[model samples]
Target: ENIYLNGAILGMRKREINRKFDEIVDFSGCARYIDTPVKRYSSGMTVRLGFAVAAFLEPEILVVDEVLAVGDAEFQKKAIGKMQDVSRNEGRTVLFVSHNMAAVRKLCNKGILLENGQLFASGEVSDILSLYQTRSIEKIKSKKIIENEKLGNAEFRVLSIDAISPEGSVLSIESGVKIQLEFENNIENKNIAISIFIVTLEDLILFEAPIIFSSDNNSQKGKYLIEWDIQPFLLNSGTYKINLLVGESQKYIVYKKDDILTFEIENALFDQGLNLNRLPGVMRPKVDFKISSL
Candidate 1:
């Protein structure tokens, strides 16, 4: 009934509402509760239903604000597809706002950034998202200390994590990068293993480098620095985040911190004509290929 009422308020005819009623209910996955009062619905259910109605109403312009954040993964995927259909197939416009950069990159061709209730920037989606990521990375202090109790038992204190080019210069796709991690061990006579995860901004773990202590070697109470090197041409041009994990014998975690550091690798100048930054996948290794005449 509320869906019908909203359709009426949106200037939709009663016949049109009836025509799309079943589709709206199906899309929302609220068929079982279609007859129930909306006041009894959960927050997710409410948002799903509301989005379904609004999206299926055939409005010339749709304004969606963080609606995907409330829906489950499946619902979010469906909602994105529906919005794309409305925009592409029906020749409508969708103005979407969200802090989820991955979703924004997937859904929008253009972007408008706001800061402190004022327009900060507006341009191509990729450029706007890159600027947003750079700003966020800039806000993170060079040295981050683990102060949250819920992250770990405080068995190990992370002093700092840094990623930079091998020569201590800016990182580029053609440059080998080094990750330097400094931490303090608060306990003695325990076996400690450290794992560093290189992840994408979308929270995808590309790979992990583990430093395992030998069985005979027990960790001592002291500060330690570990450096891991990534070869050049191994990673594509993009923003990458770091996750640090300290564990006992690589089985039990003693401390863990996500997004402890972030870095960007600019595209190599040699590939200026290739646009390698837009290439798919997390890695761009230099592979050897053999070609022969058959």
Candidate 2:
């Protein structure tokens, strides 16, 4: 790795390449394989060795792609920690890219987002993540069915789930929207519990509602439509997935589909024509606030 980094890829090694290689081998925990040929190394070992070389060389700037993800979880953790230590103690700049939002949030302070090779958003890490999350969900709006499946011996099946606006467009979700679900119940004269969950794309459940179908227990076995209203929408601007579950008394699972629907909530609230898109927290509510002297 050092030979290549020192222009040895062109068949000329730097005078101190051996010293550099030894330092990296000790740091990357590859000292035991110093005598092994590079071709015999595993993919994970190669990645670790490469990263160790790049990180320990004391370069003014380190450019890292998603290669760290090739290593195992423990190695990834250690690698991130090493980068953090480098930044804090050595005062070097590390440019990293990864689809793992949690890791990005933990490792980075500033973030730059790109789309189609064009600059999209550049700001604090938290804001950039929110923007990325929102764009990801917007892309899903163009699709009809994100997922379709049957569960529990096909006793029930969700046909389609859609998040629609009153204007009949699925591109964006405004305040006070509705999610429409169409499903088929194969069994007649049986009560079922239906539940809808509003969850972040990361699988964190933010809101959930349960509906008892006892009144419709005697309904015939056939297809049905249900509309769930999210009035006074308090969700902050970000990407979120929807989950639909149906079962007997909410205990016995009949059918449960997770991440079946995804939607993007726009930052409609603006100030003086400026977008207030960076509102903190997972939810934004229009509530009155008052402070009085006691």
Candidate 3:
């Protein structure tokens, strides 16, 4: 089975760094920030302390949430390097969740993507980040009606994407908007891959869906419809776009990639207290959490 699930790894290597581990952590440049109040430390310092503690504990599988984003630049690098050390030299596993694909690509040998809290894709870092980069940018753009476009080495003449009720509407201001995407997939092969992405105006991807493929395209011809039955389009109040593509995994030529179809989500659309402004990292899929009182 694919690893990196939340509860799979039980043994965590913890460092009793109270005295001896503190010396090691101090050498790691953590002395400058340890014992400081959480509010007083810089973002990077927090990460450094967190890394120091996690390393001292020596967890078999290191699980890092979005806390990486809170660290400073130098500390981010340090934290990543420390995590790499734990995973490699110690032969322990690491579960990292971050929107920074560059970091993910640089540090992790593997990748796991969570959408609406559900595990959507997990595999080698390159492929998983590729899928994430592709789809996460598609959700925020406005769907457009276009024709005759080329991606990579192929040219495609397309139509438009549509929305079905109870279907999530791509590039819309509302959540829970159901939608479908129809395009003229003018490609050469029967087996084709497609992925969508939703991105912010700053070109940051909000999230992405798994690589959806067509194994049943009978006629590889002029115009076609790609139905996207998206029901729960969970997003915060932000401007977004939907990017579409038709390509094969990793190496296949992209017929349409990063076509920005746009949307603007209003703040009032959500109910009171619903807008916690705390969307978990980038991947917003539902996560399963069980709590035990300490």
The top-ranked prediction according to TM-score is 1
Candidate number with greatest lDDT? 1
TM-score, cand. 1 vs. native: 0.81
Task: Report the C-alpha lDDT of model 1 over 114-152, residue by residue, as the tens digit.
Answer: 999999999999999988877777655333433432334
Q: What is the Å distance of residue 86 in model 3 from its true position?
A: 0.9
How many steric overlaps does candidate 2 have?
0
User: Model 3: how far is 7 from its true place, Å?
Assistant: 20
* Of candidates 3 and 1, the better by TM-score: 1
Query: lDDT for each of the candidates?
Result: 0.84, 0.73, 0.57
lDDT winner, 2 or 3: 2
> Candidate 3 on 1-294: residue-level lDDT in tens?
101111123333232333445444563475655555567866666555655665656676778876567756666676777788888899998888777766777788878888988999888887886677566545433223332242234345445553333523333334444435555555555566666777764467656665545546464655666655443445554445666666665576556556445544444444576645434343344346999999
What is the number of backbone collisions in each predicted candidate, taken in the order shown? Answer: 0, 0, 55
TM-score of 2: 0.55
Which digits, one per residue and each the tens of the lDDT, describe model 2 over residues 261-282? 7777776654686755556577
lDDT of 3 at 116: 88
Model 1 alpha-carbon miss at residue 67, Å:
2.5
Candidate 1 has which clashing residue pairs, if any? none
Question: lDDT value for candidate 2?
Answer: 0.73
